[model samples]
Target: MSLLDACGAGSSSPATAGGGTTAVLNMPFLEDMQVPDPDIMYEGEGVQVMHAVYDGLAQYKPGTNEPVPLLAESWEISTDQLTYTFKLRPNVKFHDGTIADAASWVAGFKRRAAINQGPAYMVAGIKEAVAKDPTTLVVHLKTPNNAFLHYLACPWHPFAVSPTAVRKHAVGGDLAQKWLQTHDAGTGAYTIKEFVPGNYYLLEKFPGYWGGDVAYDQIRITITPSVSTQELQLQQGQFDVITKGLPIPDVLKYQKNPDYEVPVTLGGTGNAIWINPNKPMFADRKLRQALVQAIDRTPVVQTSYGGLVPVQKGFWIDKLFPPNLDPISDTFDTAPLQALVAKLPDKNVDLAWGADGGAPVQQMAELVQTQLAAVGLNVTVRQLPTAQVFDLANQPQAKRPDLFIDWLGGDALHLDTVLRIMLRTGAKPLNLFSFTYPELDKLMDEAILQPTTDKMNAMYVEATKFVMDQAIFVPLCSQPFPIIARNYLTGIVQDSDLPEVIYADKIGRKLS
Candidate 1:
């Protein structure tokens, strides 16, 4: 059935709030989510759904990267940092009426490892996961990892699932992969009521949720691809909020409206241009450096995002890594770039941007294209859906775009997340350029084993500087996290670890 037919979406009235009535939160998805299963889904949109339907061992404290207790109330780490023991909360039950405990977590980890999808790397270091007892779970890693706890807190990390349900639904040893695509077996506050791909997903409050007294009774998420349509629906009280794809102009417009609450903060995400070194034109180090130095980022940031997002200062986002390192300049001389471009046999370059990025990213690409053309090159700009852009990573080097512009943030606040996921060898999906260096990979490997925060940060600094000097990835600007919601919607918190995800359980209606 269609979303409108199932949810009565044609109603003109806004969702009812307070006065002991069902509080439904209406939101829109800029693109259809891949799947709600935590083990397989890694994208931000799907992760949002997973956050509502699943509970991890730990979660980042609201507005901070610090790992705090969730399903696992308290945890202890070995001095060597190779072993971790977690104490699960008592009497927790999944949406399917199954108990959640040490065994359930162990099974979940095993299932994730066996499935071997994109997010499986998060748990690859697991040497063994054993149930010390009903409430105590012990995990041993192959090597010391300082970011282990942070990985557990990531939105894409392994979450507890119903072992009984998993076994019962297993078809030909599929580990319930098919069953989980449209269903949920988590212990979180919400359960998937209906999952209609490319249409809508309806999440109802799980009556047996361990967390007592959730705010919204239902969360209705419809696939609304157009940001303008989402804005209209929100204005007409059809949609309560537009989480993603709202342009900066509309964001500023809503900020002036008293009826809407627009919370804008410095997000962990940063926009960058990834130059494919495999391309013959960019193979030369001088040409790559010239390409990066050609663009003046000041106008690009101002014209595209209306000066809302600041030009990026470093390879990583502000305060995410240590300061005092050299900053990337906003402006550069194009004379050297022009000289270098004159020598190139092929000046034609294919530049692509994510369509899900909306209009700002396309504008940024056009501005860059203009800047590059002034330096004696022919640039062709193309807009592709975000999923198709990710698929480019798997394509052969000959088939990939010469340059890709997109914004990326770590799964967690740890420096390893950015270093290892985007630049490391064979990092799929996000590593569109397929840029890899053995020394860089080894440095990150050493950084993860550092004993103290200072030492770890120092290693990361060295790594960041090394990558910056390579000039393959050009930093553009910092993306500000903005959530436009109705004034009555309260408790909207943004986590630094996962900026794009809004925790549904934390949301509440402001009673009149």
Candidate 2:
């Protein structure tokens, strides 16, 4: 994805209300988000909520866009690349007045790894976790995993977990996952004061926070449906800060006005329509290539992003991904691209196009239909429920659908988030969304267990090639962070890589 400085929103939205000091920005789609507990959050939206009222061993800095130590002060990894020792910060207490120790962290992780117990079972890639000392935590790997650090930064990992409260709450049935689906227990800077599902949540700073002090004393987060509601509420002075989901160009027009501050934070949240290769029609490389060439990305980029973000290059970080993203890098190799599209066997293809029952998705689906049809392949745009998109992608072979239109992203934990969701065979389908390819697994193993620089690149290359060969997911575009905040909402730092809610500790009010 192109950096934020490169893409530009057409204009910023105007602010409303008598007290412009009380900024209200909007994020529509919170109703689809369910953050029942610290462990179980509504994917990306959950990350925002987790940032405000929760703390992990490592915390993200909104301004610097870095993850600093929150619970764990310092740590070490063996040169052999197997044993990882983590030393916890002492005297950290949860809102419930329970002290967090190494054992607590270990137990918390183990419980999280339980079947459906924690949202991060994927993070527990290895077989086991152990706490050797009160201040130290160790994870023995069945194989060396260098990307584990990135996994640790994930909100669902050990950093935000609390063992004592989790275990106590999880006595009868499988409690950890259940507790996480309902409760919040962590040693973060803030604690949940009140939680009314589908309504709003209030958070108060934790006085016992080991860190000097949190800048914000209170955080008020209310749920808003639809993107328009987020914008409407913010305009009405009902919000302090909001993120523009996927950067609709019309939304950016507000930035043209000087009344409200419109900051474009270069976030890692990318927007792309991933095509599943497992489908019989996508099974043909020709059809896949034809499809890529068929759909003109210009309209989506112009209409959806308003010329702010750029067309995405590859799956991983733009340059961080293998193959230098040189200027001509965006150019498509039509030979291979075309050859794949022509090779598809005559068969019915159902590309899972969950058209939000809207014109854009429907239009895009029509374009794709026409493009593939040109190559003598029949394409069925199966309009499905949004929720089934990911499930179908991750479903097992027999039950899986032919294709899915989906978006996956990464922040500081770029490789982990992308690779795990894209490759990690351990997930439901064994190969994430893509059906398993042996060569793909070998390369991933080399990157994970072998740990060689050149080999790592080779694996990524091989993996991308494998993805291209299968035509599983076709890349589309990236999204930019459009932020709106109040004047008194000082210390508001938006980390492009992480979520917006991390500002909980840094946010403060300035009474003029």
By TM-score, who's the top model here? 1
Report the C-alpha lDDT of model 2 over 1-512, residue by residue, as the tens digit: 22211221111122221243322222333444465565445345556557655666764444343456667887788888877788888877876787787787766665556544325544466656677877888877767886676556555545556666766787576655565554578776767777666677666677888665865555666666465666555555555467544235534666774435667665554545555556555555666655555555655545555666676655554523532621113544335444564554555656555433233344445565665565555767766544455355456655655655544454344444565555655543223355556676666667766566666666667667666665555565554566675444556666536444445566554443
Give lDDT per model, in order.
Answer: 0.81, 0.56
Worst 10 residues of 2 by lDDT: 4-13
lDDT of model 1 at position 175? 89
- Candidate 1: 10-residue stretch with minimal lDDT: 5-14
Error of 1 at 87 (Å): 1.7
TM-score of each: 0.94, 0.80
lDDT string, candidate 1, 1-512, tens digits: 33432332222123345346677788889898887777888786777788889999998887666889889999999999999999999999988797898999999989999988877878899999999999999999999999888889887878988999898898999988899999988998899999999999999999888888787888889998888898877876778777767788888898898878898766566778888889999888888887788778888888888777778777677735644554666668888889988888889999988886777888889999999988889999998787887687788988888988887667776778887778889898777778779889999999999999988878887887787678777888777667888777778877666566787888876654
Identify the leading candidate in terms of lDDT: 1
